[model samples]
Target: MRKHMFFSWAVLTGLLLVAIGCSDVSEPTTPTYETNLSSDEIKNSAFKSEFPLHYETYLRNDESEIMTEYGGSVNHNKNDGVNPLPEGYKYAQPYLKNLWLGYPFSYEYRRARGHTYALKDILEIDRINRFSEKAGLPSTCWNCKGTKMLEWTDEYGDSFWVKDFNEFREDVDLDENTIGCANCHDPKDMELRLYSVPLKAHLESEGKNFSELPRNEQRALVCGQCHVEYYFQDEKFGAAKKPIFPWAKGKDPEDMYEYYKNTGDTNIPGFEGNFVDWVHPVSKTPMLKAQHPEYEMWYNGSHGAAGVGCSDCHMPYVRLDGKKKISNHHWTSPLKDPDMKACRQCHTDKTPEYLRERVISSQEKVWNQLLIAQDLSVKAHEAIRMASEYTGPKPFNYDELMIEAREMCRKGQFFWDLISAENSAGFHNPTKSLDTLASSQQYSQKAIDKAVEAASFTTARDLAGDIREIVPPILEHSRELQMDPDHMASHKWFEYIPLLPESEKVWEGNERLTSENAH
Candidate 1:
């Protein structure tokens, strides 16, 4: 009997090893990220598959209902214990650009709680099936949320891979219900992990040991898996196709533009014609726009200088029941709990006033400068608009003025990015934030004025207008910086979750395949 039990244990271990492997938030505020898809609808789905049936059997055999036990409260709308999404879910943008920027969930709640909010495994697929039918969503929506679900996507990727979340969820057969512990944290060893082929390809090419970085740093990088902004270059185009980080010359936005200039060859997109942003409705000289610009600007600030990463304060590890170690997944700003151990770990001071003072002062300086950026941005837009009007659509050389305005606008946004990065705006350094913004704005305004004047009838259109690009050899440098292990934007979710092979119905191989192989 003892020998039989031991053999049973070994078999179970092997099966689990073959099971899905690999891989927050805050809130008394209630995890704002609950499922918008109806649970009843999901639970009611009629489709049954080998994946879903297998998960159901596993759950029944294991009796896993940890969500109700772990989560302190049940979701109010879902009516059952599994929490529904926040009130804001109705308005969430499909492409969620601003999310995971350290907002939504609080830090302590994230630490205290693991992911007890969503469906997983086969039951999750049932939920996916039901939810899609009820909510009118898609099954492809299940991608990246579960190993089994991601497995189902094998061979079917080219068609449904890039499809939107709702529509995707509705059409596909899902065993993966949503993002869960099995996706980010290694349930077998319980370390945060990435399961992508491209990430390692890029990292190794640049000599990065993703594991060598400190745990705190690791925490921040983990956030980068989904948090940072990225776009697919499209495999069909034979372009890089893999997700490209914007940091060739430097992580700075200007550096990114340097790469985008692509002056070396006519074959590159938007290079020879010298396109930047769409005709600045205001500053007619094409302007380079920005999304959040948080990652780069944050790096330029003090916290980053001190080697502080987002997870140091936001995803601090806490011991539960006196011994279990886990980092909080709640993805919110650390400032939410000032007195708690969160920010105090680094600040080393007890007084809220002093902390506030520091953040305010730092932010003020940056803010002052940012104001200049704002002024420059608005003024530059007007200048461009005025220039375009003066010259008509034929394209004239407001080059000097545009050079001035574009630089300022770029700097202003950079400053703003820095401010928004730190909790309490650089531990209360509003003064510096203000100062930086102010300076940037002034420069931007100057550039706009120059461009506006140049575009006037007094100047002839310089078809030969010299293209003076800033910061040389942008892409080479950007690629190098992007592949750096310490950098966050380096994450390549594009390859992190690949479609499974059609021949294999299994979610995982018999063994842990090397983390990455070919790009």
Candidate 2:
């Protein structure tokens, strides 16, 4: 009986090795193509004839109607709590407009669509100043929009970054220039390559070379090129407005905060040598606005620490033709797949329903804490605003206390923004997400205490109320709304900003609309 069992086990092991050897799913092999395209080809369509199968999957990014419980490809307003479907969703965060007041994000910010819409969406977004001939952003804003950066950078060098964003609007092709194959692959041999200058520079600064890293790490790095947190360089640094990843100290929220403290040339009394994204028009506090930091948030999380790269879940391998396996190019949430095949790739024992429920459960906890942190942050801002304007008897350390309050407000909001801006809804790092929110609440509460103490507790009652009622969500705002006298007078916070001069839309997409070409 023992001899028979040993022979059966040996035969099973041999069969397994044969299966692994025949299947590309077990170990990916480099695909060879005979395309005669130019090495510098940036157009998505240019590679279609040579790689039809891959191109078909790439075009799948155009599907934008799907919605997960917490996120989706629908291009809806993230701040609207009352609207429905394509316009807004039930899971909306109401205070985004109030929190981001005075910044362009307050003008218009929406849930992101798929990668195919990058160029088109940016051209139409209100955040870019469509009402004026000059876009309010620098050309550096185009860094992640498309592959045209390769040609633009080669032609203009570092000078490409500081130019007006609108200058290249008419110069790009909507379908061809949007993010595609060339952004992550070398057309010559189809090997993964880094096209983002910011990411490349960051890797070099760390004395690491992308090509030398393991293939799994390279897969994540390709996506990290744009999915990570970044800020434009101050003029005091090299190439003004050039995009830079703040990874000098480390990739954690606390590490990034420490790095920003001395990276800028700002000379404001308390903000000296500090990087300030914008001054909160209401709180009068210098603030740091965090962009999506998915890469940072995931770096030390459960999967990343275990050597699972982003592509493992987001771009799962699939036999699209029912023969050769290829990485699915329709980058999106794994929960969108009915089978949750991506999760099952590693979690083979769990059912799709079970995996999805776990994700939503974690997100629900983070979302609740996120709202609480946001409320406290808003209260802190209001407390500072009231305290600064107080005429009552003050503490001897009023000035000192007010400065400390502002500092806390800054720290609290930034910590909150780090998690708020990340795309995973806290599933990326649940422990870190909850911990960060707790810190944010503590700092914001401290700010409120200091502000109240600075006023000798005179304004405590003024700040005592449901924050939702005290600071109603700003439901409507835009460059156009800012010009309307009635709209400008609708909110107390609006009183801080001057009304804009009446203006008409000057451009649409890549076209400069003159009377002859106007729609």
Candidate 3:
């Protein structure tokens, strides 16, 4: 489920600088791959190879402006057997939300008004649009921009376009950016090329209408487009539904769900409608779970509204010795190397701690909310199980119940991601985490009661059916926390990374640890 864009290929496959101007031939393009400066002296570890994670960034940097200077590694520990880079390199922790800069990009953007880019902020579409306006981007530049949602047709296809995932994989290249240059720009002619077979398949899926949009819109269609969040439903599940944006109703979570419900569509059909992403464990009512929502939320925020793009902040122009070129495609937070023109133009406060503290504080706040949401959601499921003992089953709506369960599971997942996306853990803004947690708790409790209410109608005669049948898939998919590895591991204690004791539960399947085993 985790696409792993950053951690997976953040440092993989490099582009070879071919004979600079003689690139108009039909020769196979070659790439130099991961740069050597990446690996430690002769250490050819995958940590430095294909899809390598630069140990240097993870190993060095200590800006006094914040608490931790170095981008702290989940794998960093004395016993982990590797000595980090030279001292003065403070820890730099990251949330997926921002650029991997060493200093605070947000604070700078705030001080600069509008000319500057908050390079360390999360990637957004408008940001790119503005950048394109500032720097002339040719038509071919549109390649790596988006999902290319060109319409297909009114007529259905007799055979599947992408018959299976393997065929899909062969045709698509996911090596760089989970997207990259070759997808759009012609490496050979510096022109644009479209594979008719592939585009034809796409057109047919949409009732054959690929060329309906405006020229610039079509040009803008590639690259930055798919960079947004989306929902996918497969043809096998119901009728063939192609990947479509749910924005016809409107944007924002509430608006989208309103459209789905009005459509009389019981569920997503494939993903199980279950309403929105997940349900609260405590609040039994269906709830909306949010993802990066990078485009929507970022646009509404001070950053995107002000006009910032993914490349503007995270992937900015870097002067190599004096010749200017965009920083290599190693996508990460700009905070990892702050003071770049992208950020420095705004953040006049040159201190590292100042920058780090800001992001850390924000991260911490998000994590706290995550924990609260997770705990309450789990408890609500337990409540569902308890309530089930008193219910009856008359041709239970298994379809609907599963829908509910999937929603709750996702709510729990959202918390985990919030933690993961939170760059500063609890350091960014402690209050932010506290505020979100409080609301999350309230919402979760509300969900829990709803599930109990669902089963309250059961009679003695209905008891013969699978107790699970009436419980709705929401409770069924809760995965009995005791047996889930993530849930079980969540209870274990770490000297450095601690969990709330109140949140801990004894494993139903595992035995207690002995004194010797505890170590």
Candidate 4:
């Protein structure tokens, strides 16, 4: 009996040791992976044979049909409320074209596709002027599109940024150059490394090194390389058109706004010290356009403060072969999965439906407030436009009052854009989102009041009614529309922009076209 018990005990001990070994396979770990590909490999296909599962999952970025309540992979017009399906979504924002009248964004702004389409979308996007040989933008626009930037920057150095965006069109390969493996990886050993020059510069400025950061922090920083807010460095500072994150003061809206106060060489009155992205054609306000700032929005929020990295939710670990777990390469909304598997990883007790409802509920409130703020912003612009054109006797302090109104209009619109441009629909930071919108509304109202005061109350009655009726949303505008005299005459604001000369699209994707190939 004693001998039999000893043998059973030994068997149980051996089983325990085997279970311990298998447990490591179930959790994600940085196992050493050796791919013989060059350290310079930027092509997605180069890593396919070596890491088949990861490559397979990465291809899922091509699935653009899926959508959640507020966001999805569908490449629809974000400002189109009149169209259906692939052309538009139910929650479209109507004021986008009006808000961005003078900017390239007014031409065509659509909901983004997955990262795999980044190169293709940017090439075809109406925001880039394709009709002209000159792209009308700096090469800096290509910074976030692909891994080829790694090669381009290496070859051209600082001069790469100021080059015409169209200069490199014929040299890029869509599939290979689209954002992929090499962007955040060291091809030598599959370790995380920072490839974005701006992100690296920002970190180093703060005396932080990417390698020294905790692994969890490194995961979020990889996403931050492209996801954070940035501006092209004005020539006065250093490298002209080079992108720089305005995180010197802090990551919050007010902090970045403060940092922008003295970053540019724009000598326009009232905008002397400010970094101006563009001057609003209608309001004549110096504006700051916020890019998609997911990283900034999430940084100090609930999940971020609690130590959740971007990958923890967007790229949850899953068993592809039903054995070893890997971080899913298909980066997308956590709510996209019907099971809410990513959320369940942390909130194990909550049902998927409950969590989803909570998210949509927060978004609904935010969306409503966002519309209100946008309406006020439109009213402010109208007020300023009227005040600028007023012919009656002006107040003694009219110049000062008008400057204050313009400043308010600038701040209000920027605050609105911060939330509007962010992809999360306020789920990333609901408190910050709602607060910013509320502040935007107040600033817009103040802008209207100051504009009226500047005009000595002459514009109050004109600005009092429903804003939608006052300035109907510019439902359609594009490079094609600008070339048509009738279309340019259709709107009062269209007068601010000169009509484009008749021209054919000179380039599409990576292909430069002759008349035979032009569309």
As a TM-score, model 2 comes out at 0.94
Q: Per-residue lDDT for 172-204 in model 3, tens only?
A: 212222223333333333233332233344446
lDDT-sorted candidate list, best first: 4, 2, 1, 3
List lDDT for all candidates, in order.
0.39, 0.90, 0.35, 0.90
CA shift of 335, model 3, Å: 2.4
How do the predictions measure up, each by TM-score? 0.50, 0.94, 0.45, 0.94
- The clash count for each model shown is 93, 0, 100, 0
All models, RMSD in angstroms: 19.8, 3.4, 20.3, 4.2
Off by over 4 Å in 2: 1-29, 32-34, 515-519
Candidate 1 residues 245-314, lDDT tens each?
Answer: 4454665534665654542222322234332323332233333334333444455567766778876666
- Candidate 4 per-residue lDDT over residues 1-519, each given as its tens digit: 999999999999999999998886765656787779888988889889888998888999998998899999999999888898699889988989999988899999999999999999999999988887788899999999999999999999999999999888877889988999999898878989888999999988989989988888998999999998999999999999999999999988888888988998888887797898988899888888899999999988898889988999999988888797888999999889999999999999999999999999999999999999888999999999999999999999998999999989988988999999999999899999999899999999999999999888988998889988889888899998899999999988889888988888787777877553344
- Give the Cα RMSD of candidate 4: 4.2
Q: Model 2, range 168-255, lDDT digits (tens) per residue?
A: 9989999999999999988877889999999999999989999999888899999999998899889998898899999999998889
lDDT, residue 109, candidate 3: 16
Candidate 2: residue 106 Cα off by (Å)? 0.3
